[model samples]
Target: MQKQETTRIKKEDKVKIIAGKDRGKIGKVIRVDKKKKRLLVEKANMIKRHVKPSAKNPQGGIIEGEGPIHWSNVMLICSSCVKPARIRMNILDSGEKVRVCSKCNENIDSK
Candidate 1:
């Protein structure tokens, strides 16, 4: 897939998992991989990894970490409504475009 120039989801944005095993779980966006079309959500999509003893992990047994979830599997939760909503862009009076929730028409981005 082609890399998107921009994404509606950003780090620290609160999001809700709409699909996959973690569906209905809500968490903050930890990071975004635009090229892979995935987002690392905090405490979602947990996966186990077996690692050998290393400097970083002396015990190096089984470890768990957040796995990337396809962006399509998640939706932004509107702050005002506290529910999942689709986002739309609109130009403000100052001509600055901002993301807003389609369900509530509230600003998704604080800026």
Candidate 2:
């Protein structure tokens, strides 16, 4: 029997917020929780949480941080033209696969 691969998005990918209070905000994916289908985006959808004192922090206090947002609420942003566009996979001459921006036909990982 052959093993199957999970087709979930990965970290460091650019994404744009499409819903919630932080709609339209774009940021790079810092982390992904596949079990929860939530993602932590850099500088996007920030929230405040109060913490109790512990060994690490003698004086625990309120901290501002980023919260996980649903994957359905975000659209992948293309690195090619630096815009929020749909993605389409393509094969290069060297047989390498790459994602392309459906709008600009440019390579997403040109950088």
* Winner by lDDT: 1
- Summed backbone clashes in each candidate are 0, 0
* Model 2 weakest 10-residue run by lDDT: 1-10
Off by over 4 Å in 1: 1-6
Estimate the lDDT of model 2. 0.82
Task: Tell me how candidate 1 scores on lDDT.
Answer: 0.89
Candidate 2 TM-score versus the reference? 0.78
lDDT of 1 by residue, 1-111 (tens): 645455698889899999999999999999999899899999999999899999999988999999999998888888888888877889999999899999989887764
TM-score to native of every candidate shown: 0.87, 0.78
Report the lDDT tens digits of candidate 2 across residue range 1-111.
322232234699989899999998988899988888789999998999999998987899988999999887888877667777876779999998887889999977656
**Relative to the unseen true structure, what is the C-alpha lDDT of residue 20 in candidate 1, on a scale of 0 to 100?**
95
Instruction: Give the distance in Å from residue 38's predicted Cα in candidate 1 to where it truly belongs.
Output: 0.2
Tally clashing residue pairs in candidate 2.
0
